[model samples]
Each structure stands twice: as C-alpha cells, then as structure tokens.
Target: MNRLQLAKRLAAMSVVLPAAASFIWEELLWLHALALLWLAGAAICWIGIERKHHSGQMRRTIHTLQAASNRTLNHHRHDWMNDLQVLYGYIRMQKPDKMVECVEKIKDRMAEESRIAKLGEPALIHYIQSFRTLTNAVQLRVEIAEGVHLTELPVDSSGISESLIEIMNAYRFAAAPALGEPAVLTMKLSMDDHALYAAFYYQGELTSEQRFASKINQQLEGAPLRPVEAGQPYGNMLLRAEWRA
Candidate 1:
C-alpha cells in the first residue's frame, strides 16, 4: 500500500487504542495491557516499514552504481584512448577549430562528472545515478546548477528520498514508447535562498498523468521536499522537491 493509506490505517489504530482501554474491567485489565502492547507493535511496524524503505533505497543506490560502472567500462573500453587519439589527429591535420570544439565538449562532460562528486549529499548523488540503471527506454539526464554544493541533509531526508523515488518510478512506468522512440527524462538540482531544490521533467507516455502526479505529491506532504510548484509543463510533468536551507 502507499504511504498515505498506511498512515490512515495507523491513525485509525491510534484512535481505537485509547477507547480500547476503557472497555476493559478489572478482570480483563490484562487485556488492556495487551491492547496497549498491540498498539505499540503497530507503531513499531510502521516505523519498520519506513526503515525498510530507506534500506531498500540504499541497496538500490549501490547496485545502480555498480551496474553503471560496469556499463561504462564495457561501452567505453577504448573511448578514452580513442578521444585523445582523435584530438591528436585533428592537431596533426591542422584542424584547430575541430580540436577546440572536441576539447570543450570533453571538458564540459568532465565538469559534470566532477559536480556529482562535489554534491556531498550521498543519498542525492546516488539517487541521481540510480536513474542510469532504473530503466532502459528512459534516458535520465541530470543537470546540477553551477555552484551547487550540498552538505548532508537529514538522515531520513524527511521523505525527500522517498518522494523522489515514487515520482521517478511513476515516470519509469510511464516511459513506455509507443512509436519506438526513447524518452528523455530530465532532473535539475540546485540551491537558492536557504532551500535546496530539485525539479523533474519527462517527455513520455503516462497511463494516467493525474494519478501519477497525485502519488508524487502525496509523498511530499511535509517537512523536507515541500512543493513549490507541481504540474505538467506543456506535455511533460514536473515535481519540484525542496528542503529548508
């Protein structure tokens, strides 16, 4: 079940807990204690579910990183040497313009890679990378605004991680291409005015866009990951996840 449904059930149990004690008389007093214990168990169960989710994210993050590295090595076994050799050839051929363009692109890519490490927020960095392996058709694109350097957020992130995961999963499911065209999913992370910001956008098919958006917004109800603006941009969807600075 979704977190909201779980929360509603837990709230119901909480309401019933106090009333349960009044119904027990002296002879049945032990039953009241049992009921209290049962309520405590339910609370613990809820907490456990949250912890389990966090653990799952961490595991997925590690797996995704491993898979990404493997894919990179397999795909680019000769890429480094090839690029440099090509650049060297350009120089020998008196192609200064081409050489400058190639070097600029390479530097830009390296800068982006460096930004990921400088993010400093392990969970966010890993989450961004996890998209690499999350789906095949959806090409995940992450843009870190220049000067975006983050420190460790809350241990639990107050649901930022969970909400972003939910949104991403929805987009993943919605990314099935009808015309064999691939989907381009973009996410931007940055900081402004004492708040951290994340915005997601995707161009793809969604079985139910309304349902997808609602599910995402629900997870971002409180604390970290507050929504500044959440809606569809043109044909794409966006959820701006944020936390206090």
Candidate 2:
C-alpha cells in the first residue's frame, strides 16, 4: 500500500489499541473519558479517510468520461472528413451515381443518430452513441422504430438501459478478436400496442458460445424486460426480449 494508506492504518491501530487497553484495565474515571476520546478520534479518522477515497474515485470517473467524450468527438470529426473527401473525389471523377449513394448513406446515419438522441433516457442514449468509441471489438447497429420513445413505456427505463449495456458488454468481451473481423451486433428496438421488443442479432465468432450465452443470461436476471427466447439460426445468435406495458 501507499504511505498514506499505511499511515492511516497505523494511526487507527494506535488509537484502537490504547482504547482497548484502557477499557480492560481502567481504574479511574478519567481513563474512561480518555478511551472514549480515542474512540471518537478513530471514528473521525475513518470518516475522513472514506470521504477522501470517494472523492478521489469521483474525480477519476469524471476524467475518464471526459476523455471518452473527447475521443468520440474526434472519431465523428474524422468520419465526416472522410465522407467529405469521398464525395469530393466522386464529384471530381464525374461519377454522379457513387456521389448519390454516399449522400444517402450520410443522411441515413444522421437520421439514426437523431433517433438515438431522442430515446428518452440520457444514460442509454449516451451508452449507445458512444459505444463505437469505447471499443473496436464489435460494430453496433442500432435500429429504433420510428415514433418509439423509451420513456413512454410503463416499465423502468433505468433498468432497461442498464440491462442493455450489460448485454452489449457480454458480447464485447466474449467475441474473439484474432479469429477474424470484428463481430457485428445489431440491436432493434420496437414498440407494439401493449409491449416493447428488443431483439439482438450477433453475427460473428465468439471465443466460447456457451460462455457468451451464460453471460447474457446472467446479466438479464431481474431485468425489467423478460427474455422471450435465445437461439441460433443460420449460424447466428438471436436473442429476443419483451416488456409488457
């Protein structure tokens, strides 16, 4: 441990040991008061130490989040630059067909991003939008049905967001990187008259299929939505879940 931690432990031991001895062999009233004073000092020291540790943790978390945000912004900027370069190249080559295709792709991507932003849960929106910058192990394709807002549902939004993040993490950690290209994970969110549906389609190689399935199941335990089914069809994994209104 660091010197600060070692010192705190030493200080705690000194006060506690003296207090214990005083209680065991005290012959005077003043000795009891001294023991109580030592006990109070120990408590104060413990509270201070805990507060300091928590404050440090909070600062670190903020720093990490800021760094991630900066990275995501850079990635987005780079993507736009590349897109513009491609469009410029197409225009210079006098190829109108490829230029139209590239513009359509950009429009679609922006529309999807706009939908994700209005998902009604800040945490889930951030998680989904920043996921690309978080890792390179998986390519995430999120499809949110038009007019579907998560907050409109009667279920717990936070729980749904947490469960979705955990599910994504399961695939992210289980996918084999060296086997081939990064895996593609598609998440489709749709709503019906009485329920909401989330379907996960994973098309890629996993280090261990059983382990990935186990992790997904474990993460979904006690989640807001119930698992409808998990199966493999055409050598691809499909997991479906639904939340009734």
Highest lDDT among the candidates is held by which one? 2
List model 2 lDDT by residue over 54-159, tens digit each: 7888999999989988988888899889999999999999999999999999999899989998779988887887889877888999999997677866767778
Give TM-scores for every candidate, taking all chains together and pairing residue i with residue i.
0.59, 0.84
Given candidate 2, what's the lDDT at residue 237? 39
Which model scores highest in TM-score? 2
Give candidate 1 misplaced runs (Cα > 4 Å).
1-69, 72-89, 152-162, 178-180, 230-245
Clashing pairs in 2: none
Tell me how far the alpha carbon of residue 1 in candidate 2 is from the true structure, in angstroms, after superposition.
2.8
The weakest ten consecutive residues by lDDT in model 1 span 234-243
